[model samples]
Target: METLANLEAFMRSAEHGSFSEAARRLSLTPAAVSRNVAMLERNLGVRLFSRSTRRLTLTEAGETFRHSIGDKLEGLQAAIASVSADGGEPAGTLKVSLPPTFGLNYLMPLLPGFMERYPRIRPEWHFENRPVDLIIEGYDAAIGGGFDLSPGIVARTLAPAHLIAVASPAYMRHRVPPVDPTGLGDLDGIVMRYLRTGRIRHRTMRDAAGREVFAPLRESLVVNEPAAMLEAALLGLGVALLVVADVLSALDDGRLVRLVPRWYCDAGAISLYYPSRTLLPAKTRVFIDWVGDAFKARKLAERFAGSLS
Candidate 1:
């Protein structure tokens, strides 16, 4: 009988197109994944991959094998996960990816309680601004917005990914507040340059009653990261378009206040992304549920809506 490890190694290698990438997702060394693939190929007595320095292309037989085995293997994994359920505590290293600001502001507070409840589960977190390839990068879960839904990943929303205009109390104290988004251009604007596209964005905002307006800012200061832009806004440099999750506590504490509060941009939804519902490990499942429960207890969804509707 073929061992589950060998089959899994082969399957992941096929999916990721590189032994190194498969190793990352499997939490194994590349040599181990290579050897496992070699063993599987030997057992089947056929060449499975056309390996090159830069690419691992599937052979005709390999493609056929994958077509025949893909769903079967997924079902088997689901069955195995189901069978492993016991009335015991879940234990493992939970690897997660999160946006830095939101992680520090929101999710970090939930950690102490999570750690106390599941002492055996160790947390490994990566805080970054870029969206990650969860399956390829080997995250148990990721929390953010604007991530591509790769073949096997799923997203559960936590709150609205809404952007609202905000500025320091000092900055707004001297300036007349805009009655509408169109009037925003008259204010000093701290804006962000998108890292991926290298462009400054102007949003078309919507009011609660469905009025739309093209909002433009003066661009008095420009920064590449949200954290920096937020700091600039706090320093009274200019008004900023910031994500609601990034500024919730600041807004609550009076460091920042909403500008043109009735109008906001709907970027997307803040979400928790995990590999598969069927393939969830105990640690991952608990973490997902924990986040969902916390969001409910905190009423973050309602607070994150900039339209306040």
Candidate 2:
């Protein structure tokens, strides 16, 4: 039988299309990955991969082997997960990936409470603006704002995030507030650039007839970080489009004012996502339940109060 280590190396190489990428995923050197593949090839007495200076190609036998081995590997993983599901206090490290601004503003603040409730489960967090590959990177869970659900992942909606347009009180005092989205065309504003794609995105408003329209706002500054953009807006640099949760404190303190009342962009549901499987660990399930309850209660209270106004 081929060793599990060698099999894993081969699978990683196949998935990533490069020995170096596989090694990086496994936290090993390229040479180590190469050696593992070589060992596997020697045991099987066949060339698994044809390597050249420019690329690595799978052999005919290798393609057949991969198709046969993949299901066994998945079955083995599921069996291990089944064994790990034997209930106890959550005692392992849970690696979570999250969007930077939302994590900092909302999730991170709640973590202290979670930690106090479950002391045995240590969380390793990676907060970034870019998209994360949960399976390839071995992440336990991720907090995602977009509705894009990748294959083989389970997603649970956490909250409906609000996207609002705001400007500092100082800026508002000097310039006339735009009565509509079209009026915003002449105003100075800050634009947010996606870190991964480097594309600029702004919120547009719909007219009373329910037609979507955008303004020709000039971007005085473009930034990748949401926090930095918020800070710039606070300093009276220009107007900013940001998640409502991120600027709640500023809004309450009268530092920032909503650009258009009762008119804002709708961001789809934010969700907690994880690998899809028949069974989940007891600890992960408990945490998910707690988070759902907490956010739901908060949202209900907000809705009731909004209706009263």
Expressed as tens digits, the lDDT of each residue in 187-234 for candidate 2 is 778888887677987666543345665755578989888889899999
Which ranges in model 1 have alpha carbons more than 4 Å from their true place?
Answer: 50-60, 149-153
lDDT of 1 by residue, 1-309 (tens): 788888888899999899998887777899999999999999999999999999899999999988888667767765676566465687777999999999998999999999999998999999999889986676889999989997888999999999999999999887889999988999988988998999998889999988899988988898999999899988999889999888888988999988998899999999999987565777889999999999999999998998893
Off by over 4 Å in 2: 1-10, 17-62, 116-120, 195-198, 206-215, 281-287, 300-309
Task: Look at candidate 2 and tell me the lDDT of residue 245.
Answer: 69
Any residue pairs clashing in model 2, and if so which?
A: none
Query: Considering every candidate listed, which one attains the maximal lDDT?
Result: 1
lDDT of each: 0.89, 0.74
Q: On a 0 to 100 scale, what is the lDDT of residue 158 in model 2?
A: 72
Q: Lowest summed-lDDT stretch of 10 residues in model 2?
A: 300-309
Error of 2 at 129 (Å): 1.1
Error of 2 at 75 (Å): 3.6
